[model samples]
Target: MLDELRNDPVILSYLQERANLTKGKIAEKLNIDTDIHTVCVHHFDYIDTLRMMMFYLFQQIGLNVVFYIPFNPNAPDVYKTWREIYERVSGCDYSRWECVESSQPNRGTKFAQYLDKCFPHQEDQLDNIRFLSFNHPTEFKEYLQKNPIVNNQNEVIASYEKDLNIYTDCTKSDHFYASRYGKFFLSLQNCKKTEDGIFLTYDDYVNMMTSGWVQYGSINGTQALTLLVDLRDYMDGVESFQNIMERLQSLVYLQEVSQVFDEVAKEQAGRHRLKCYLSNPFRCFPYVHQSRYQITVKQLIECTKDLARKVNRLLLAEREKKNVQLYLRELYKIYLTVKDKWEPSAKQKIEKLFSIHIPDHWEFAKEELYQLLTFYLGSTEEQENKILNFDQLIGKTLSAENIHVTGLSFKTFPWKTPELPSLLTHTWLKECIRCSFIATNQNIRINALLVDYYSRNVTRSTALYSIYHLLAYGNGQITFSYIKDLQENDGPSIYFMILEELYNKEKVNLEEQTEEFSWEETVTTQEEIPKEPLRNIPDLLWLDSDFCQRKFFLNAFVEHHPVYENDFHQQQAFSIIGKLLAEQGEGEELFRETMFPLFPQWTNAHKQNLLDTSYSSGLRTYK
Candidate 1:
């Protein structure tokens, strides 16, 4: 029968012609077994392209085919034939049969009102023709046989109504009526009243399936319970079905939804289920896409944890690969630079060059130093940690001035260099002794030994000279005061006491010399002057001196000042000399500490002839 329908030109033509009309109405009256031979394709709108493909496949596979056209509006005497079919087959139900219209008028127009006010003019003409055509039974029979046309007497299904098998007694089971009656009840309630009739439509059928009406059997507890449980089970299945249906609906509405939502959902679900094992680039764990996950919530959490570990491992491997590549490039450059000149003996030289001796007090071992250097190299990452550890061990040790040496003898000093002569490298004759005084981190502790003699009324020059002599020969670290308590009973001698302890360790013989300076001992240069009584001295000076001797002691005092104060004194003294130089104006050479000529040359006449007198500026006196 399927082959017959496919090959039959008459049936194909009819099917093709009526394709535009709603298949529901056509299939309703047609005496056709829909399961055996399909006349109307279900969901054809969605699968038109698919159907075309299938049609070609069938053709390729040698199936008989024809293009169908059943309900052609331009057929000969279509209005007459349609009216006859509607009147007889539709059983005078004008609501069920649509009127044959020609040149439909717009609503609210005079022609539309006229057409709507009375019946269609085409309908009268159709009715007249229908009466004439079907008047003879022989002609109608011929029409049915020749046209493969369905006629009035054929047993057809009623599209609109279902017969309810009403149970007079409540015990009779009724599934269809229970399912459908609620829809009918609601439809009757919702429909607008019209003078002609009720338009009980297909939307009412859809409401029966979707609304909660079909959920219950009856008011009786037993039936209601059974019905509800079944409905619930059915609804659960229906919900899953609804998901698929909604996705399909989206395809129809794709133009409106932008298609991305469907793509995203599909991609998410697909990627989730796809399992993969990783391959290298690196010998690490597999990296999988998390979006394609389809596991349950608990499983998803576990999967995420696993994925994180895998991703971390992969990242580590990639980092190693990058490091290897970088190393390889560096190795190639090294090969280019040193390949020909490289020697096995060079290893010893390289090792020796890199070796360094850490200070005795410093606590780092060789391995520790290597680690420290490694940490320094890793300054790209753990810089703060490295710096913190380094600070903990050393913490600016060189920043101190009064560094008291304890273990090493003052006599055993580090290597002395002529290039950099310093009292620090000089060894005292005994164990730890007085060292040159410098700032202990710039926190001043005034040494009283330098000023003790001055306080006792010894000459300032003599005291200063002694202090300078001690500083130039001293060794080890010097200890001194950081604060001066002028109000203390110690009388500013505490700083000096600290120095005296260092001086005692140095084996210095501070025996006083009773003999005064002789002319030969005092005079070393042509410009030397004789010492005189030092008047206007506070109860501090123990000697008298001329300007030259006083100036020599002052210069010594400047050098013996604490190291930290050196910069300060230098700046202050320079400022004073600079002012003096500026007053003197431009000259042949600039003034400096040692090289510059001091005093102005003066030509003087005593009685008959003028003579040149040489005088020196006292700038070096404060050096």
Candidate 2:
């Protein structure tokens, strides 16, 4: 690559200009100019995945990321695939990144790589040199136990004396939200006993390997997170991974039985010390919740930063490229408006965090998030820069562009599924609860969930708004993709009808709703549709679960786990109740008993009319 570059006219001209400029500058600084010099970047190209791009941006961490997949010597690894690809594509031998037993890791200091920072070797810098490495969690934990480096610097004890490393922010002003996870691991080095006792539950596990514990983790939107875990996540009323994301909450203090150090949380000895070793935590964890506070300001900031990246991408697309300067100016104005509105209060809150200082520098991170917005606005200059992205600034002015929107499919895009579908129709399930039965966890919850999903807002204008606004981002021909026909018995998403309502119009003013959707017409049109149609598109799922591994694991666990005969009784309740409800028979008494709490005025008359055979079947389905 260097040989080819050296021969290129572009390189020659650039090098010659740099040489002449450097010579003149050096001559002026000194007495006379005798020799010419060449100037070029000492750093190599930092090739990395798109996932790592955003953080490299705000944190300004100078990391030359290289992708490496180590081979498993005993079994097949990525080494074989790369070798075959190289042989087939380029017909060359590929020998990089093979992990043979004899091939030892580079045990040199990581600071050794940074020439500008560590090369000159200022005596003060030499004493404080930190080597941060990105390594597997198992290897990192092993280094902490075995490596003789007791280099505890501030909040992190990075692996400086050897090959493994725990990543830390170079700038103290920016606190990597994930750093707290390392501290929790670091805290394990000390056995801090708690008299109050730790949270213990049935067959619990502190699920690390979460994106937060990962070093050089996936950069994809589906797997990345700015914050490792939210301690105050319990406050959320919604059903999210927070309900099951016990990354830290599951930590338990335990002592080994018979000195094996493999005892689970259930096993313990009287008057024994808490085991804080990594090796001890297969069945027992070392640390427990020390203190609780209604605090997660850092978390909030990190969440906001993540949201800002999303909003920034949208606005960048919306930018008027015909007048780039004016577009940036307008965006800056809006940014300033938000900053001005939120700044004073945010400053006070941050100041309060700084003033009330705690050990481990919990809130010691300086006010640096504002710089993110500053960087965002300043990035307009480097529109071609990957992080900033080319905001249509580099494209040909004469070229035609088309804006295409996809995933206009039903509930997939806007995702307006009822917030609490079980509550909507399963009010009757409370009777089973009164009889000491928990209906919420039963399979019958799906009867309401599925029904609520089908009859979900045909009136929701979000689909129209999103499509129009997203298209407004581009000054070009607009087109969209939609699932016009549902698979087999299913009909197209109800959103299709909602979108069609807008498409038939001559003009749409979102502020003006000309008329409400005619339910009679919608039902009449659906009369010829097949029965038991699918509501959602189905596919095999694994990695792309919106980074919620807990949900994925739990879902698969529930499906594959062996079921008792009695469990099937509750599971079949959904089909039975759904059949009776559509027939408008038998379950009127159940609804009266269960739903009276919600609507005490409702009576059997409501149910009889609801189930009336006189009504059209299609109309009854919508009802």
Candidate 3:
């Protein structure tokens, strides 16, 4: 029979067209099936073969052919057609013929019989099935008061829906919703609303049947089943669906990019290749087709470009950080080489260190380098024996009174090098000055070095402002002289700015001391005073120089008065003026002159109270 079917041109063409198989392949498959006891026939491909001939051949070969028919007992036409097929195939061989019925109760009569047997006392079986099918747990329980049998078909469906809900409810279960729902719920939560309708996603029906939850059947011993179920409703617009899909795709792409970045960050070779790969837009758009991702081609391009830009920035910053560390390591090596010898060769190496161009992001490296150089320069005792002047050796002209160093001119000093200004900023200079001051025991040498360096650097104003507070730590005579020179050269405004900063720092120290000893007596004699000066006066007579002291008091009073608008600067100014007045014992005169003229609104009582408190042992009036 198989040979005849393969030779007939009409049958061969029909089989090829219907089964998508060649005549030779169909004949081969048929011959193979003949030796088997059971034969499987595709329900859809039944029409492609002569059914009677196939069945007769199966019987002749003592083989049984199985047909998985989707039975619908309620429809007469469907029932009649299947019955006719069965009768025609069975023929007159009643002895060999058989009919196997599915165990499921399909018809109402069969279902009634099942309910009667399983739940004999149940009267509302119909209502129970309806309630369970619609997921109305409340209605199902109410109907169960009269009792109902557990019908196989309805119970299987109810169990499936229950398990599905438990699985999709991410709050309860950790199942991968994307694998079950077609798309992740987190991405779906960002869905937009529109007027027409809320569009829905296409659920992965194939995954549902194969999911372990369904394949393992119900825990209650219910039969396993597979059915096309619409788990989610479509209430969003098409645009919303597309938007959600695009967002999901973007999230997936970003995760991939992050993984690549992490890998690149781990290896130098990977980082070198990152820039080239980052520039290519297609690298982030690996899954760009509509079938795999619903995003449009234009959107995919835009997203890739945005991701590439962001990733490139991250890579650039990473590279800059790495470069900064490398430069700092090189600078440290040069410092070590020149630590002991201050010879011409060592100076040439130091000159090369400063000659390299500094990138802005390497500000930390620049700071560290300046600190290292300052420490090394200050530590070496050979400078006095070298015969170079302080100016030539340090590349800055200083007052002879500031630092009397005797060192011969070192021709290899990097004074002639062009990148000196680029190597130093206001911050770097400040750090250098601090290191030098500490190393030299708050000597005028550091101040003079800074004064000379700032005179040559374009950032003199900023540099001066940064180190202004350091003057308070210097000797009284030198501080007074420096203030006098700054007032004369940079005008009274810059001088006043310096005074404000100095007094502000002093005020904070005074307040902290007061709080520490506030429990002591309200009044103590000047000599009995905690032996610690009320404040370490960097220049006791600096403020006693009537002209400078009076001018600063007046400026502070006018700017920080209560009637005047208050801000952080005003509060700071107020604290500075209060501390100076209380500590200097000159508040009585200043208030009578400066305070009275500024605000005449004060009464006699207010003036007397202010004077008494300012001259008291502690800052009673300020608090």
The best candidate in terms of lDDT: 3
The C-alpha RMSD in Å for every predicted model, in order, reads: 58.1, 33.0, 44.2
Could you tally the backbone clashes for each prediction? 28, 2, 10
Evaluate residue 441 in candidate 2 and report its C-alpha lDDT on the 0 to 100 scale.
35
Which scores better on TM-score, 1 or 2? 2
Task: State each model's CA lDDT, in order.
Answer: 0.27, 0.29, 0.32
Across 1-623, the per-residue lDDT of candidate 1 in tens digits comes to: 57966877878887775454443444466654462233323111111222444443333444443332112233222222223222332235434534344443221122122212342233211110000112222332333344331212111111011111121111123222133222333442333223332222324323422332222122211222222222231122222222323322322232223233335456444543111111110101001121222222233223223322322321222112223333224323432333233333333322332343333343332234334433322212211111111111111122322122111112111111112134532123112224434444111112222122122232222222222222322232332221112113223233233334433333222223478775755655687545453332222122212334554354233221111123233233334444444335462134332212111111112100110122234433322
Q: Each prediction's TM-score against the native?
A: 0.12, 0.19, 0.17
Residue by residue across 505-604, what tens digits does model 2's lDDT show? Answer: 2212112225867655444353665534422212222432456666455433433111112323322322333234444545546644532222111234
Q: Which tens-of-lDDT digit does each residue in 166-268 have in candidate 3?
A: 2221222222232322122222222222343233333321122222212111110011111112111111122333433444444345345445544655554
lDDT of 1 at 399: 34
Q: Give, for candidate 2, the lowest lDDT window spanning 10 residues.
A: 382-391
What's the candidate order when arranged by decreasing TM-score?
2, 3, 1
Model 3 TM-score, 2 decimals: 0.17
Instruction: Score residue 63 of candidate 2 by CA lDDT.
Output: 24
Candidate achieving the largest TM-score: 2
